[model samples]
Target: MARTARGFAALALAVALFGSSGCGYNTLVSEREAVESAWGEVQNQLQRRNDLVPNLVETVRGFAAQEENVLREVTEARSRVGGAATPSEAIEASNQLSNALSRLLVVVERYPELRSNQNFLRLQDELAGTENRLGVARKRYNDAVQRYNTTARRFPTNLVARVFGFEARDYFEAPESARGVPQVDFQRRP
Candidate 1:
């Protein structure tokens, strides 16, 4: 009878240890998932911006046929964003593209007809809305990354994170040049 009791105590101890170990692994997995989900939101918002570009370009084209440089910059920036390899790279490229697009919009201010065009106005509104959504998405992504990184580096969870190959995620940060509204000069050549 005593032998049976000792065996039952040993089993209970093993179960408790196993359960405690699993909690850390579970937390690490949850944190990584949060980061990934937030990244998806950021990507969706970026795609929304990409979808608005063609209409914006067309609207501007009608008013100024000679502004090829600005149009080309927007196109190249779009391509870079499309081809970005990593999440950090994508965020940087997207910000650059947004800055170029902002400069193009400033050029629109020079043409009263373009500014007053209903199509242009509508595209502008849509772009503004997309930018707002992108900002929110970026913030959410950063928050998620922060949480994940903290968990990946914390004591108990860190051990599980290392064992499971869960690494720290980079935050979506805007470049210094893109930290403020882009400066646009529209002075006409004499």
Candidate 2:
């Protein structure tokens, strides 16, 4: 009777330790994967936007050839976006691209012909849709990062996270320049 009781107690202790650790580890892994998958979606949307920008730029250029500075800025921003390798880097690059594009779009308003052209109008609509999709993807990525960070920082899992080196991830956030509406100045040309 005494031997049987001791064996049961030992088994129970092992099960308890394993159960807690296993749950914590598995949850961390699942949440990290969710964040990764979300990041992939963000990258895809960014690529789509990058692909669409040249067409828009070209269309605008045909009508407003003198807006060379604005066009060059957009081209530079798009290039930076393609070069970004990490999430934080990507966020910064994407925000710059957004700002540059916003400026380009604002400039477009100055050219009634560009705005009214069928090709330009269609490209503008597509770019607008792509921006909306990109916004959603960024939201999803941030949500996933929140979940993973929350899980990694929580009790029990925090210990597991440390043990496994599952660090927190950066959320996709817009910079100040990208957050507000682009300022429009009807009085000047730069």
Candidate 3:
């Protein structure tokens, strides 16, 4: 009777431990995966934007070879973005690229002929679409990061996260310069 009672006590302890751990463990795993997947999507959209830059640059070059400084700035920014090692670095580099592209667009407005070119128009359309996609992906990544960080910081799940070495992720925040709406006056002369 004593031996049977001891066995039952041990089994109950094991069951309680397993039951408590299972939910927390699974939540951490899934949240981490969500962050990873979202980051991948952000990278994908950035890559698509990167791929389109050169073609767009070449098209602009044919029309406005004199805008060397603007073109060079865009090219250099693109290179920085491509060479970035981490997410923060990539975000900073991408912001630089965005600024350069904005400058290039302003320069494009100065050349009416370039704006009318079929190739330039097509590339511009594709680039605009890519930028839109990048925005969506960045938002998704930030949302995922928020979710993961929340899970990692929460009481019960945080215990599991700590045991498993899961850390909170940084968010993809917009730069200060990006906070303001860009003044794009298409009707006004550049």
Task: Identify the leading candidate in terms of TM-score.
Answer: 2
- Model 2, residue pairs in steric clash: none
- Local distance difference test values of all predictions, in order: 0.83, 0.89, 0.88
TM-scores for candidates 1 onward, in order: 0.83, 0.87, 0.86
Candidate 1 ranges with C-alpha deviation above 4 Å? 1-21, 181-190
Candidate 2's TM-score: 0.87
Top lDDT prediction, candidate number: 2
Clash tally, candidates in order: 0, 0, 0
User: What is the Å distance of residue 108 in model 3 from its true position?
Assistant: 1.1
Between prediction 1 and prediction 2, the one with superior lDDT is 2
Model 2 agreement with the true structure over 1-190: per-residue lDDT tens digits: 9999999999997677657777899999999999999999999999999999999899989989999999999999999999998888889999999989988978987976666699987887898899899999999999999999999998767877998999999988788877677675534444
Q: Report the lDDT tens digits of candidate 3 across residue range 78-168.
A: 9998899988898899999999999999888887788888999899999999999999999999998898899888877777788889988
Error of 1 at 147 (Å): 0.7
Q: Against the hidden true structure, what lDDT does model 2 obtain?
A: 0.89
Please write out the lDDT profile of model 1 over residues 13-99, one tens digit for every residue.
766655666787888788788888999999898988988887888778878879989988898888888888889789888988977
Candidate 2 vs candidate 3: the lDDT winner is: 2
